[model samples]
Target chain A: MSAADAIAVAGVTKVFGSGNGQVAAVDDITVSIRKNEFFTLLGPSGCGKTTLLRLIAGFEFPTSGAIWLDGADVSDTPPFRRPINTVFQNYALFPHMTVEENIGFGLKMLNRPKAEIAERVAAMLKLVRMEALAGRRTNQISGGQQQRVALARALAPAPKVLLLDEPLSALDYKLRKEMQIELKRLQAETGITFIFVTHDQEEALTMSDRIAVMAAGRILQVGSPREVYDAPADRFVAGFIGESNLLPGTVERVSGGLASVTLSVGGRIEAVAPDGFSGGGPATVVLRPEHARLMPAAGAPEGAIAGTLATAVYFGTDTHYHVRLADGSDFTVREQNRPSVEARFHAGDAVAAVVEPRAARLLRERP
Target chain B: MARPFDVRRQRGFTVVAAFCFALLYLPIVVLVTYAFNAGESIANWEGVSLRWFVAAAGNAQVIDASIRSLQIATAAALIATTAATLAALATTRTAPYRGQAATFAALNLPLMVPEIVTAVALLIVFARIKMATGYTGLGYLIAAHTAFCIPFAYLPIRARLDGMDLNLERAAADLYATPVRAFRHVTLPLLWPGILAGFMLAFVISLDDVVITEFVKSGGQETLPTYMLGQLRRVITPEMNAISTAFLALSIVVVTVFFLVSRKRD
Candidate 1:
């Protein structure tokens, strides 16, 4: 355990129900969040990301482990006893209170002086840029304004940690984009630990300093957005973070921290192998859509996979090429639509797909 | 260019609705109209006059009974609503346990059984208490009304508590509010309208209760309804109609307020 960590979830498992009906909502997860880090838990529905956030927020107690906040074991404590606050999925603002009052609520609950409450509330209002709407009821404000108010209210308490549960899912697209930038700025300005939970990979990739990708109540990978995206730890992480083409292959050899794999689709490619060496077995090669290119078979690089160009569709910013590899599986490739990045190969042409040396990764298939 | 589904267009629909309204309001309408009759006879209206209203007001028994009714209603409504609020929070706020359904059924027992049966049961139970204590006061009547009005106070409050977002309570707790403080600051204010509506319902229910009051009350404890019953047995006059009209108006006013207060905003 590091002293710099703001929170540590040590082998926590939260189980719901009893006896035969039991199901673990958070299954044996142990992770540490650094102080002032914008940490995100990204997963699909029923992945227990929200449940883990609740465990950190002290709403749900772990079935078999402890939660440490600032060097204190707080798993047995109630939510009110902890110094953490949450921005709920629905905002959960007091409907009867005005925006100013909602923001001042946590301060008032802490029995801060009335003058201090007013000053802090004013500062928060300006921080979220809701000074003009201070007197308005929370229901009276627009959705985006309500989101800002939720942020201001959660941050006004200067909590040691803030837990956000899909706070932007209710907002429209434009507002969500705006709030993503606003949230990062707030986290930086406040310098408080923010543990956010969402299923949207792009949101997590864009706003998070580090992300824990979860599935089926188990965290699959934890790394920076780029680390988890460009060099995913395994099959699930690679598929979830972005578009990936997983091709079956056998590991040929491991040398110089890279493994060359012989593809079943009639080619061989080199990939930066994962940690730990001296292994030779069946492995899958991960090729990212944006990392590959299409060219005529005659001009292709050595050992490049030869394929037939099946379809090329323009997507404004990029063109998507669906080429059928030798085994007749679709080998998808995406190219940026810059002037020099025009699609030269059309459908029904003999083409070869070239993968950059760094773009491929070897995942050893579990026996 | 399709027609909307209108119930009126169906055969016998308008007839059935009109018949229902007519049956429900026809008696009250007849009584209200006769309350303004100038003559002493309730069956014949001589002309429009304020004589019956004035006579009813001037009668000392009517005034005494009216005052007693108001006092009992206020006390019963306040106590019943308080008890019902606590009961509602207890039942709905916590996780369900064994016997929770039975508790709910018991709370609403007075409404299910016939009023006469409840009155008779109370009569039997109170007879023993009275004989043992040798006490006869309005306390018994108030106690009976309170018991009967509890379910009246409970339904609206329980519905409101059910419809409320439970996350608001969690949010309050996350903001460092103690359980009591969360209820005081967040839960209570949102539940205020429901409490008010429940109180009004309990007030109206207790104000006009007859069978229980008849069985439970001691001597000189005649509320307006019981007093009217006594007058009906003695003589038939427009004064009774005036009192009934006033009672009907009071109920309508309270129920209207209850309806307005219980309207959900969100």
Candidate 2:
């Protein structure tokens, strides 16, 4: 509730049921969203991503906590009174009205002059690239057209924030990718804060300025896509945001803010702990697929461990290899499919997986 | 892949469908055609004439009764349809709550009970009121029609409300309209088709009702159906057929107009 922040949710908790049956859909979440940043809540299914969006939209109320918007406490304000709009996954266009009429409906309710409403509606249609379809009924238009109209309708009001709940989910794979870019562009042009919710990690990484990776009704970590991926706060964040090789281990020694850990698979590894830990304790090591280097031949070199290439999947731009260590644990390594590395390794080939001491992160071992 | 054109072989099924339609409509067809007969006995059909039609048109009591029925049906349809629309909106747009099922059952009770039962119940209530103050207005007929027509209006309107997209309303709210404004602008306009269809259906049903009207109506409160019943007891003439044919034409016109408007919306 200041010039910098458009919306702030403080200690918001949303519980679904009561007594013996209760679900904390959003548990004590507190976050301040900036004026015009495209913030996203990214998580898998049942992670309360959509629930948090609905809470911000005023469709659902917090069990205990306050939501402030533009310096006003709107915790108890109904959705219609709040200065926010939501674009649903299913573009819920009014079937009875043509695109022009549906878009002009809000202006009409404000008792705006008929000419003014028509002009604004026309401008909006042009903005959304749907001017040609203005006269057509909603059912007559395609899904993407309807989606554009829905965006036009929500944006026409020029609300302070636009809450999108998986608006691109209904589109096909190709359209989803296209609209992801379009949505970011639209957010940039409008300068309205967009609180987008999705279970898609790639969409979040591609579109959001900052992403909050959530799980089990709590935000496990919040940061830029690169920050969260490269330096995960916990094991869940590392596993949820992208593909990573998580190895269970215990610290053997701590020296100069770095720890040498021995894995359950009987492999010794050294990793940097930016957050210095107590010497000789339980911990886990996380290495991103891209961080591990694959070298031909058995037996580790100076800073490497021996493993066999159990499987190699050749993606278009990158080849991912599942490396099975001598002690029977398997981890994945992705190498760029460059011409130089094309014929480097194959399945069943003995290889040495190498990593820099700084590339590996010491995460808390999950019980 | 299997060919999509395999459905063409099923075209022969229309023959049986046509026979079934004929069986269903044969009696109404006979009734309608016989209304044009000029014979003294309906079975004879000696010739065709417009005399009975003219008589039906000029009958003052019949015309007044028809006007009264129209007025009551129109008023009842309006009231019932509006209440049903609000009820439908509440059921759909609001958050889930307790007591919603009990409210639903209460509103729909009249539809589930037999017409005779409702008629008797209304009669008793009206009789008690009449005995207390003798202040019976035409309001009784309006009340009865509205009660009977609510469920009819509710079902269709609720279907439309259930299928309605909340996105438009949310968009409207974000645009700065209050909740009431959103309902008026976005929700109501979208719901008009269903409301109109439901109202017209209720109007037709109310106009043709006999049992409840007979139970509650006082002297000098004859509706068209009750008047027609009285005419039947006294005489069975081509005049009745003429009246029946006119009513049938009117119903057809109403239904056709509704469908035409609804089709344009689609």
DockQ (Cα-based) per candidate? 0.72, 0.52
Candidate number of the best DockQ: 1
- Where does candidate 1 chain A have its weakest 10-residue lDDT segment? A358-367
True-vs-predicted CA distance for residue A218, candidate 1, Å:
2.1
Per-model TM-score, in order, reads: 0.94, 0.91
Question: Runs in model 1 with CA error above 4 Å?
Answer: A339-343, A364-367, B10-19, B255-266
Number of the top-ranking candidate, with TM-score as the measure = 1
The C-alpha local distance difference test score for the whole of candidate 1 amounts to 0.91
Give the per-residue lDDT of model 2 (tens digit) for B151-193: 8999899988888766667666666678777777678877888
For model 2, the superposed segments whose C-alpha errors exceed 4 Å read A1-3, A101-126, A339-344, A365-367, B1-20
Per-residue C-alpha lDDT of model 1 across residues B1-266, encoded as one tens digit per residue:
98899878989998999999999989988999999999988888799998889998999999999999999999999999999999999999887877999999999998998999989998999999999999988888889999999999999999999988888999999998999999999999998888998899899889988999998888899999999999889989999999998888888888776667557543
Q: How big is the RMSD of model 2?
A: 3.2
What TM-score, to 2 decimals, does candidate 1 have? 0.94
> How much lDDT does each candidate structure score?
0.91, 0.85
Best by lDDT: 1
